[model samples]
Target chain A: MLNPTITEILLSLMQVSYITLIVLVVSAICGLILGTILTIIVVKKIPVLKQITVTFSSFTRSVPIIIQLFIVFYALPPVIESMGFSTTYITATVASIVALSLYHGGYLVEVFRAAYRALDKGQHEAADSMGYTPIQKFRRITLPQTIPVALPGWGNALIHLIHDTSLVFALGVVDIMGRGQLIAASSYGMNQVKIFLIIAAIYIVLTFLSDAIIRFFEKKNKKFKLDSGLNTKGA
Target chain B: MNFLILFEDFVQLLAVVPQTLLLAITIFILSILIGTVMALIQEYNVPVLKLIVVIVKLLLRGTPLIVLIFLMYYSLPDTVTFLSGLVGLDYNGTNIPPAIILIVAVSFTVASFQAETIRGSFLSINKGQIEAAQSLGYTPYQMFKKIIAPQALVEAIPEFSSSFLIVMKAISLGFMITVVDIFAEARLIATDNSYYVEAFFAAALMYWAISAITVTLSSKYEEYLHSRM
Candidate 1:
């Protein structure tokens, strides 16, 4: 066994921590945008589209994100390569974005669907009596109400996405977990167990910080009173 | 555009259906089995076991599942090698079953989640129901078996169904640790054959079937139980 050292451990933890935050940001943004579009289509209630949205959303949620990343990283390049595009960091980033988007879209659809379903019918009827069109009613009433109702589920989605972002390590993204595993392997060879411990500590730290952000949002959004109002109904 | 090719691989991927379902069902059954027993212990406030249960639940709930899978894979072989060397079993040289490892890791994870749901369900029952069974001179086990267990299971059905789906989907992590489940196999086929659409669509179909069957089964159970009530 190699002699144990403090320096190697510190270096490894630093590298892994930075990667974790980057992956979290990338995945969360991707999930947010895709979630919005899917939420719209799902709420629009297009005849065939509703079933399509539900099916796609639920399937995405049910499948493993690690497998999703593997499929995207491995399969997407060749599919896109047919158009004479070479795979690069941008492609990889875009592919991860798509994967994260698809994964979180499943969550967003659920949030929105539940939000739309939970609103009392009287509000819509009230809007209708005022001669508001479906789109207008949605814009003025349904959409506004959905925001608060979806806030809590949306928070859960964000938390899940942050945690799920760790799976991107398997896709060769070298995210936090990827970096940790690398450092751990290297440290094992070098007899630096403290590095592995430090890296693990970093994950715990980030998770704790993330939980705080979510809890803060949840408490701050209590004014909407839509959380309980939403959880019981459509979801 | 490539629908026919995808259709063919989709059918090919169906071969993994049984394995996926088996993993899911095993984890569901075993976790619930473990979870219920643990929950019962918590209800009785069993001292040392309760502390262990709390810690297990926290770690299980706190860490991501993939991390647990990795930790288990590495830890088991090391332990097995050490044990075999000590006991002279001389059997550590053989490969351990990936499916079994995956089942154990995922089941424990499910148990952490399931125990919470079961406990919640159990506690939700009216106290009088338990006392009523006790007043009938029933022992704690008899009271739980007759009155509490059935109600908790029914109350917990929806959460359980969703958790089952999550666990079913989670088996895809096996591939990361080099266990060739359906998704893992599809990744190889897609990469080797350059049939991304075909391979992934095929896997997606299998995933859909699994999801459909679970949802249908749970709903059926829900209806049957409601009618009986």
Candidate 2:
């Protein structure tokens, strides 16, 4: 087969990356929200559900993002297709979201659980006495507090999802790594190395930026975030 | 296809079990060994290594390990094969040297995370505990060995086992590199039977089982760690 041109390959990879941003952003939001819900489930049933939640989170958490990506991108499409749904761009978007939502949601579960655990019970009771509905109390009294608290860990998951975007190459989605692979296939002497290394560098820089943002939020919530994780006192 | 025919293929595929387990176990042992040292270096703030360690921490922490597997698969064999020819150990396909390369590549990543667990466990030892050791006239090394290491190991096992579970999930990357683990075998079956669903169902169940065992082991290890304290 003829080797594709360097510029074309790079452009294709870039195009893949452009679409990937949508996946990452959507997945980030969905994962965090779903994960928060999962956290609430665990909290409501701390004796049994808590253990199950923690176990599921840590188990999924233990798997590498790459395998999860493969399971989502390659494995799921066929499964979905067998059920009669077309899974074309779902390849990129749904796959990323599924992989990430499961993984990132796991991380968020802990963060939300920790944040809720650490909130002074007096605040909840105070809101309760004022006749606030549970939903209203969560929106005003609970969620805003948890967002700042969860930001650091959630930010880490966001960066992680970005880096993981490169793994879309498994089914040839033409993301940055896919582009690097193409570039490697095309050029001579050091061009392949240059392209791949550049992609890796971009990934690193993005993560560093994420770490900074996470730290920023962490500082904002340092008092709450630190004491949140280990404070086992009931609400 | 008849049931017996598929059953035979399943049996054949099961033969790869040893390879998968062996690869996972050896690679993890090596990774933990390397990772603990890296963790210790990061903990004690070892000289100029900290900068390198930080760079590595980011690289391992951020990059999808499958990418690392690819880099190792594509990069290492020629150099390793060439070097081995001189020593005449005759290493190739049988040993699946590429798998070892993937293992090494993965170690670098796994170690970065494991280092955090180690560092956390180490730091959790508290200042007075270290002071008590120093008061007993123990050197820093002596204190770590006689006092800190025991507690840290106990504290770390639960998390470390979880890390091991993480590494096991990572082994799915091996399929990409042609290690012929269950996933790869399943793919081959999918191709032959054109039953992508069945093959994948088999594969998913296999992965879930593997995941279940891993979770069980880690939790048990956590319980064991708790007992020692």
Candidate 3:
């Protein structure tokens, strides 16, 4: 029955941005590391570990992220406590980051693996001929190429992650969605649609901004590669 | 980790499988129907509707589905009342079910994704074939039916399956709206059994099983399609 003021809407949007920023930054960093590790484990085909990692990735990928969120938020602490670990300090935000990173990391592993597979065998051979060690070859040759190829998919994962951060509200995190609910609740259940429409618009703008940023990097990467003259068959 | 409790919870959660599956099926069918229309509109490049389609796609795809769900579940009655008022009709608009609202919200988001998939397939259709069809004096409908649909369908199948999986995963969010889907059932079981970990684990297994089956079926269907080609 009450309209949210311009200031209230703007303030809520700002708060949402802060929460989203935290989740995105944390998930992106942790997911990249986790994904890379999973990719390597699979690619190197480690005994037992490879199969286990593959299954874990597959399972995580198949299940909904919200389910994963619930597991991490609710199930994991008890499981951890049963194993003699304390999780008293694991707040909702931490749970959200952990769940989201794991969820996105599963997809990122596929992207990294596929990008690595797409590279020509000659690249590896060339690195080997140069007396480069495995790690050195990966650092100097493999990563550079894989990054460009994986960037678009990674960008998509980031966008998806951005949308998913809203689900943190289900954990009662007072994120943007939570704030919208609060606004609606304060209005005695009125203006629910109007408030959410505004919030959704803000999200659309955020999504557009992320897309533009990713596109800009993609273009810059292309230009940098062409100028460096590594633009061979891989290019 | 009580086995008996987990088993009981699993059985209880199983009862909601039909609701979950029906929601997924309804959303999948409606989204595909809407997606096909959007794709066709894009193909024709209808002036005003094309702009609206692009805007709708961006809006739906850009926003999180939960927000849309809240919008739909909370706003539909008000919207109905407003519309009815404009038309001079008496309406209270309170009998709508949450499941229907969830389906409509999720379908709007999924339809945008499906539209993109269909549009990509349409874009992949050969320009030369279209020109040849035109030279043969084929109408737009005839050209689409004979020359475009089959080719696009082949290209679209993989994306369609992926979208189908997405729709399946998405309905789990319906639990947030208290739709009594399996996920919601799991929460209730957890509250009742006080074994949150075990209850959620059982639910996860169920979700994983459905997803695995869908993936297997899609791959097999893809193989069959390839064999025909």
Candidate 4:
């Protein structure tokens, strides 16, 4: 009773889930890698590089994701084509993933950098005094500690990226919103309202799921703290 | 990569500044006015209105802005017309402008976030200050006007400035619904000239510059407020 095109709605849901999962994985991986690198650069105070990272982060943060998507989707192909790369590979999905990952990566950089900055100066001093290598210090102390600090912001970023996936439909990608568009078009807009309301509900469920997952991690972190008598401060 | 071409592109993008500003400023003002009311309701804990505000805030925050705009611009009219027909009323709801729909959708989202920001600022005001004002024989309105309002307004400025930048970026979404803002204008020029990169690069620069100026101004204002304190 939601809409006459229940099957289309289901298909769109599947498509939406598919796109969201891909985007989530792609953006998470890209964001983490890039964010970590940027955080490290900042932590080390790499002369001009730190300034560059800061500027890049602020610029990316300021730009709208939709504008970024359009720029990448339309502009990137021509640039790639000029570089002797085929533009055929840059579909709407690819453009969406690229733009979304980069956008999320900028935010993740802030989260990761802030988390690093929040750690007590004594932690680094202790590691240094113990003759721990920089890599060892990062792996054994910083990485583990930063996770709890970064989790909430990282979770919010992922949820935001998921919400942004709905915009891929604007690029003609058959995401949930695109699916709604398709169904509305096919049904001559008879069920547009129902289709969109259903899509909104789906988004709500996705965001709630992400929040719950973050809560689960928070609880686990709390339990770990209680057992080990170690606490990671939230900044 | 041509400097002259890029300059031309920047000009084309700049030409649409008026429309972009109109969209951003209009929605921002509406959102702040409406958002303040919504925030005050939650602040005072009005029974039914508080519940409704919570629900509305959640609904707005949970859904993507694009979905809201799409629904308002496209689906709402058909649904309205159909409902009206069922009640034996002849109404055509399709004549509303996309700009108006964009405003409504963007304002709803902005208001939700603004309500939260405004509420936080309100909560940050200490009870002792209000008590002091009360002891001075100040009316409730006078208490708000003289003490609570000043502190909250100063506190709210930093957050409000960032939201102002956000509203500016959001105006780009109006392009999706064909509202002829700067983003839309850039897209048109890019399509016409087939220089997508140059056109969009110009658009990005303009957006970045506006936001950068906003950040600088906001920080300066915040410093001035702190100096006053």
Best by the DockQ measure: 3
What lDDT score is found at residue B206 in candidate 4?
86
Model 4 C-alpha lDDT per residue in residues A68-187, reported as the tens digit of each score: 888788777878999999889889888888888788888888888776766667778889999999999989877767777678788878777877887877788876677677777777
Q: Which runs in model 2 stand beyond 4 Å of their true positions?
A: A1-15, A41-99, A187-192, A220-235, B1-14, B77-96
For candidate 2, write residues B112-225 as lDDT tens digits. 887888889888998999989888899988998888988888888777766776666577677777766776777788679765545544555555666678768878877876
Best by lDDT: 3
Q: Provide the lowest-lDDT 10-residue window in model 1 chain B.
A: B58-67
lDDT of 1 at B223: 90
lDDT by residue (tens digit), candidate 1, A73-186: 667777677878776754555667678877887778888778778887778778999999988987877767766777767776776776677677666767656666666675
Give candidate 1's error at residue B110 in angstroms: 1.6
Q: Give me the runs in candidate 4 sitting further than 4 Å from their true place.
A: A1-8, A78-87, A223-235, B75-92
lDDT of 2 at A91: 52
Candidate 1 Cα misplacement greater than 4 A, ranges: A1-7, A47-49, A74-89, A122-152, A184-200, A226-235, B80-95
Candidate 1, clashing residue pairs? Answer: none
lDDT of 3 by residue, B168-209 (tens): 888888877778777888888888868887788788888888
- Candidate DockQ scores, in order: 0.37, 0.32, 0.73, 0.63
Candidates in order, interface RMSD in Å:
2.9, 3.4, 1.1, 1.4
lDDT of 4 by residue, B84-192 (tens): 9999999986876788888988998998888888888988999999889999999988888889878998889889998998888887888777898877888898889
The DockQ-based order of candidates, best leading, equals 3, 4, 1, 2
Whose TM-score is greatest here?
3
